[model samples]
Target: MIKKPLFPYNPKYPSVADLKRRAKWRIPKFAFDYLQGGCNEELNLERNESDFDNIYLKPHYLKTGGEIDMSVELFGRTYSAPFGISPIGLQGLMWPNAPEILAKAAAKHDIPYTLSTVSTSSIERIAEVSDGKAWFQLYHPTEDRLRDDILNRLKSVSCPVLVVLIDVPSFGLRYREIKSGLSMPPKMNIENIFQAMICPEWGIKTLQHGIPSFATLKPYMEKGLDLSQLGQFMNKTFTGKVNMEKVKAIRDLWPGPLVLKGVASEEDMEGAISLGVDGVIISNHGGRQIDAGESSLISLIKLANNPKYTGKVKIMMDGGIRSGVDLGRAHAVGSEFNFMGRPFMYGVGALGDEGADHTINMFKAQLYQVMQQLTLEKVSDFPTRLIR
Candidate 1:
């Protein structure tokens, strides 16, 4: 007999497919494509999941297996779950006031919610929503004063962790973005206007709320432009001087856990280790940076095997993590912290505030199924129970 499904919404609420569908409908086309699409060829995007699929789980039937603890501590604080919301910028453009909605949901669930420095919501705004259960992602500025002021504000709000996104030396080559002609302040063209008009729900909501822009940068920016304008400012503001000295300087001023994101090589990992870093996430900026770049998982294998860095510094990762099993595989490969960037954003974009909880619960369900099938009692056992 065919078995019945566990969830009511789409048989299992918040599945990756369901979440994707919802996000697509709620967000404008160009905005959705940027979040969902990868660079040219998307080789790494596919590899991110195929790498996990290539690894299987070895069941331990005799081991205890009940009441699995999903809680984890990372960067000096304990989180209710092993996963946290990854940073996404221009969230307001995707869905109005999206940062607050996601932040509130993350807070309610006791998970970490990170806000990008370029996000439309202010740090204080998300702090209010998430009760400061927030981390900040800095795309380092060229102006020292601008960087200092940004850091000072984060300190004032007491954001616990500061993430430095270094992979994006230049923005990833996003083709869909080029075709859509959908830039910020959304310059309406015949094609875009027609498309926007086609999606009445999204269009009406956007009209009522007004188009979302960089609210955080409003104080700093006087002149605005569409996608090209935003891109130029991004190029100007997010400078290329992200080096060890800069990180050391940031460390001196900020007392929170300092994470160096987009470390793809062991050399970079070692550099991060030597710099008084608290954590280094092996990533390719979720396949959004380079078209031909290697998958973060494959890169993770090389970095995690080096005994010099093992257990000395916390390792985190994110890319093509669409299920709980994927999370299991990432940890098994030596990552202690796992961040999912698109899933939670897609969730909130799909169903507003409820998206956060629904997506988390969806992962909980999938993770539980994987754990029980493997007959495992705890997450720490994953390294041994892993099958190649």
Candidate 2:
């Protein structure tokens, strides 16, 4: 007999916007700003979402279809959905134990969970929670020894994929973060303290979990370093710029699937291919890197349509993707897989532990609904439904 499926999502928070609203109220202002704010005027950030509105999908009312299949395969493994949680740094500041909570949810949902090198949760801890299914995103360290050590640790935990970030040559100047004193290692002034007081839930959870730190980098960091010292260490340790030499060096070192995040042009894609990288994530650091950068959608459209770059390497995208319809649009365009950072964090911030599962379920349900409406049975058919 066919068994019935369980509905796990909260109907009240059916959309990412709903989660965002609830999350904003539950977390401190500084935390909310860090999660939501983009760099400079945030024009690129606004465009990232608005650009999706231009993409139209055609539905076939008379087409025959059975059950909708949302399953997707990437890097030799199948996932419940095409999208996964993108890596985010300082996740605990958004909500206590945010990385662990999302990692558990991703594993439960059979979706990929990427852990940032600078996140609050340690690599081993996340790997343990995700049962070693989690992916690791590395920010190339200034020291080769440090890089090798981190890679070895990830290998020890049996990480399946290694994502190298290439966007932050120099960190973007986010006005909100600067204004709120939410820099690296973060400053806890009187205003920040008051903001924390207003969000009692976040405060209590933070107290329980303790202050968020750079968990992955803890081994390299000196003990008892203050915020100022930590900032100095961070600056001294991570060089933002990534050249072809750096990519090639990492390519030589890492044996697993090597993916380059922050690819926005065919030139960058070509560079990734030339260096023997396995995949490229077409992102603009969620519009936190360049204020004038093209949206990831535009880049996907350009590269996916180009025969030169289409089949050479795996192409994925992440930036301003907030809904199931957006996912469908992305697939219709060119993204083989998709990822979102703030959405999952927003999920954790909204409902704490339950938020991750709820958010994943919501995306699955919405994507399924869109597929059903279009009379498309498989995710691969989404391209055909694109109204060009």
Candidate 3:
């Protein structure tokens, strides 16, 4: 007998691509561009998705399985799935209350939800929504005092893991944002206003939520700063590259699992292992950081195949993953864990409150179908099916 999907999702938008297509029309073009565009020429963005085509998994037709168990353990806790939501800054800008929507859905689904420091939701708010199981991704503040304060806040809420971003030494040059006036110190032009007017649903939601601001950082910011002033404040607050010293400092301060994100090379992987980090997320800031850099999957293959770093630390990856099939592909290539950013946002953008749940369920269903086809009983068994 065939098994039914564990979670119910909208059949109308069954895949991430469907959600993306619907989202393009539901939200303003500026918002859609921000959610979709990568840095510079977007070559890296194209490569991030296109590179997955190179990965192929072998299917076994004769073998039988007891059951496909999707649950995986990380940082002393078992999550419902091997994948989690990646941290996306300004989440509310794309869809009002996006972070909260994702957090609640993650809690209900029993998967990890990572909240960005610059996201439009407060740490406490996300913690409340996710039952304090959410992971916090810090952007590495320039001031030690601010860093300590943020750490203390995380401690108070019992945040499970702390992910420090190391890839963005400087913000990448995104041409779309520059052209749309979403560059640092954003502007509200006539075109932008007209775009918003045409998207009545988005405009209504924006009115209900008020203007999207950095909810987590509002305490540190002065009252009533305009767009340009807000940009200047952000630049001044987080104006340095995250170095070894900074990671070491964060490692010493936080007692829980500490992960360094934006790792693209073996050299950086070596550095992370030396610092005694709990894990390292192989990422290129989802192809938003350096346009000329290698695709994240290529970087993952290099680190995963290296003998020296094997089993030294937990190696995870995130980039170009749009479906359960892509998640399986990443696993086959040695990604111990996986995360996705834009797909979830697209779900919320296209479906509103139900979007996160639909996206999560869709991924779960797709992965289950793939595993059943391969007679694969576990997610870790994917590497054995890798066409290496």
Candidate 1 residue-wise lDDT, 1-388, digit = tens: 9765442233445588788886787676777877787777677777876777776778888776687676787866777667888888778777777788888878887788889887878888888788888888998888889889989888888888899987876666667666776433245578766766666766776777677767667667756465767767766787585888888888888888899989998778888988888998788888877868788888887788789887878888878788988888877878787888898888877877667778877887787778788876666667887775
Instruction: Write model 3 residue lDDT over 1-388, tens digit each, in one string.
Output: 9877587899999999999999999989998899999999999999999999999999999986877899999989998999999999989999999999999999899899999999999999999999998999999999999999999999999999999999988889999999999988888899999989988998899899888989999989999898889999999999899999999999999999999999988789999999999999999987888899989999999998899999999999989998889999999989999999999999999999999999999999999999988889999999989898
Q: Model 3 compared with the native: what TM-score?
A: 0.98
Lowest-sum lDDT 10-residue window in model 3: 2-11
Q: Please report the candidate that would top TM-score against the real structure.
A: 3
Q: Looking at candidate 3, what is the lDDT of residue 33?
A: 93
What is each predicted model's overall lDDT from 0 to 1? 0.78, 0.92, 0.93
Tell me the lDDT of model 2 at 325: 98
- Cα lDDT, model 1, residue 304: 83
Q: Which runs of model 1 end up more than 4 angstroms from their true locations? A: 1-14, 182-186, 223-231
Candidate 2's residue-wise lDDT over 339-358, tens digit each? 99998988899999899999
In model 1, where is the ten-residue run with the lowest total lDDT? Answer: 5-14
Candidate of highest lDDT: 3
